[model samples]
Target: MSDDEILMHEIDTQLPVADFSHSSPCSAANRVFVTLSGPNFRINNGFETDDMEKLYSGLSEKRSETKQNEFPLIYLIAPAETTFDQIRSAIRTAAKAGFADIFLVTKRTPASGNYLKHGLLLRLPTASGLSPPSIEPIFVRSDRDGSIFINTGPSQEALDHCREKRSLPKLNETLDNYAACARAGGFEPIAQIHIDSSATYQRAIDVMNAMQRCHIRHITFTDVTSTPHRTCQGMGKGKPGTPTQSPSAIPRPPQIVNPVKR
Candidate 1:
């Protein structure tokens, strides 16, 4: 079989299963596939290694050959056993190498057809791209037990604030409170989610859904090491003075899945 055929075969066998709950299909053109197998990162199911520098180099070369203004879309295939930190690092490296668009590849269900042939794509923000000065980024972290914490800095006080808010089960309400506070201060809120190494993909999905429900779509996935130290914006500050509407009362974000190629 040809190289393309071989790569497709590898993706079919190794991609993870995720329920994006979107009906739109992803296109098959102008895209590159990267997979994480155990401890190694594989490019197009070919060059495989644990060294991130090599992976960055490979992605940079691919970036150089793409269209002048259009970077090739990246399809990342990581199994359930892979850590969110691993996935975050891969995405950060890809962005640093000049590839802007990236997606997490997964099947709609376990019994679904070959992922490459029939699967849903979850588009991830390329990196912490520049935002308006009027917008401030709020840091978020999710624990394995479905507890989520949010703060504006990486200091111990911020950490403690997150821990305090862990007992709160209403994620959507907590996030909405933050967004309202930021808006009240004339600053738009952007969320930079920090996914722990032990956190599962399902937890990440839950967090994403919560962000969507709160109308916070300008989200970025950040690695633990790159967290910034800013002034602590207390997590408890967003508690609404009056009763807030439920998440179901909000309109959903528009689905923008690319057209499928025949």
Candidate 2:
């Protein structure tokens, strides 16, 4: 069976009986991580197109007088080239429905990690082609910053391996980096670096050492995608490199506090 099929089947078997059932209107009464998943949407040149109403309908739960607190965290997937505006729209719609937070998957980083304003979950996107050791600064930054997601590549081969579990080119560098950093401050990187890879928990562990990372209280190993994990398609992702921001506005890398004289 195809990886997607397996995922859908799992969702069918595991989707909670109450997940789709109507519930009394709730407020921030209960803390819960809600999953909002969407499939197809139009993305090109960093723009995403979808029906806002439909997106909301998928997330809404009926309310009753006895209101309970519920904190919903929406997760959305982005096709290549999905833009910022579309993401904004998604977030806007979800807020109308009272979502507590949003988690997103996109090829590029957002305009800025300004997610806290809207309670958006943050992911740390590492630079491609650079070794993990070379990017230690970013890792340190991510750890210090708190609540970051790290995805390495949209590797086609990685996706293929998820389908068959066939012997494939392992992302050795990414793997090694995760191992080295997993112990630092008790944070671990995910094995299935990319969401495009299957989200079966076993598949992830089979690929990389996520057991420790998963155990880290400060870290989260997000693998809900491909598990039919609910996400608002094109909810919100910032444009890459903050292109519109002025040079002065962009953050500079941390400088060595005590560099020896040249």
Candidate 3:
């Protein structure tokens, strides 16, 4: 079997990636891209945590009626090997399903793994000349046993640029040194595995659904109070109070602070 077929069989037993697009025109738009990684021991297995803190950022902004059309684009970052074939398969599947974007970050392989040529799977579009709705691949470099550092967000452009300048021996040496340092002191093996793609994807979907519901509520409230006058008891009377709720009912700030400020 092909690598794609092998990965498909290894991960899911029920359906193919192509089957995901059949649900709705917006199904792909609601899909979340998740990256899986762990200690070398658990690298190929699943995660064991349900940490949703990173995934819930910016939810409120997109939860309003005016922005209901927008959905959350989730990118999971982990220190694993992101193969080119897997990246291509995901992009093709997501593109067909109408997703806005797909993203993943994995560890850079050593000279082995035949990843030099196949590594293009992780490369993102620096220009429109390549493809639409670009998929980002982040490659983290680690020493033989170092904990990996993953970059999955806006820095994709910088990494791609750096990768292009591979001829620089100085740059290559710096990365190697850093990886070695990380392996010596920073590497933390996972005691227990937790969160994985399916869990993260479900949380994303839930967040999107909640966002849509919140948007609907906002619209309903706006429409209820937008009227200047209401016909009540056979008399045209102006409503004094629109009966609106405070946006701060939950007492939340615009952003979260780490609290343990020095």
Q: How displaced is residue 71 in candidate 3, in Å?
A: 3.6
Model 3 ranges off by over 4 Å:
1-33, 36-68, 76-80, 107-262
User: Which ranking of candidates, highest TM-score first?
Assistant: 1, 2, 3
- Each model's TM-score? 0.58, 0.27, 0.21
lDDT of all predictions: 0.50, 0.29, 0.24
What's model 3's overall lDDT? Answer: 0.24
Pairs of colliding residues, candidate 3: 47-194, 47-195, 48-193, 48-194, 48-195, 49-194, 49-195
For the record, the alpha-carbon RMSD of candidate 1 to the native fold, in angstroms, is 13.9
Candidate maximizing TM-score: 1
Candidate 2, lDDT over the whole model:
0.29
The C-alpha stretches of model 1 lying farther than 4 A from their native spots are 1-28, 106-132, 135-137, 144-146, 152-169, 180-187, 220-262
> What tens-digit string does per-residue lDDT give for candidate 1 at 160-249?
223323123456676788889988898755676656767755456556656655556555454344212111111011121211111111
Return the lDDT, model 1, position 139: 63
- Candidate 2 Cα errors over 4 Å, as ranges: 1-52, 58-70, 73-177, 181-193, 197-262
Q: What digit string (tens of lDDT, one per residue) describes model 2 on residues 198-240?
A: 2332232222222222221112122244444222221222132
TM-score of 2: 0.27
The lDDT ranking, best first, is 1, 2, 3
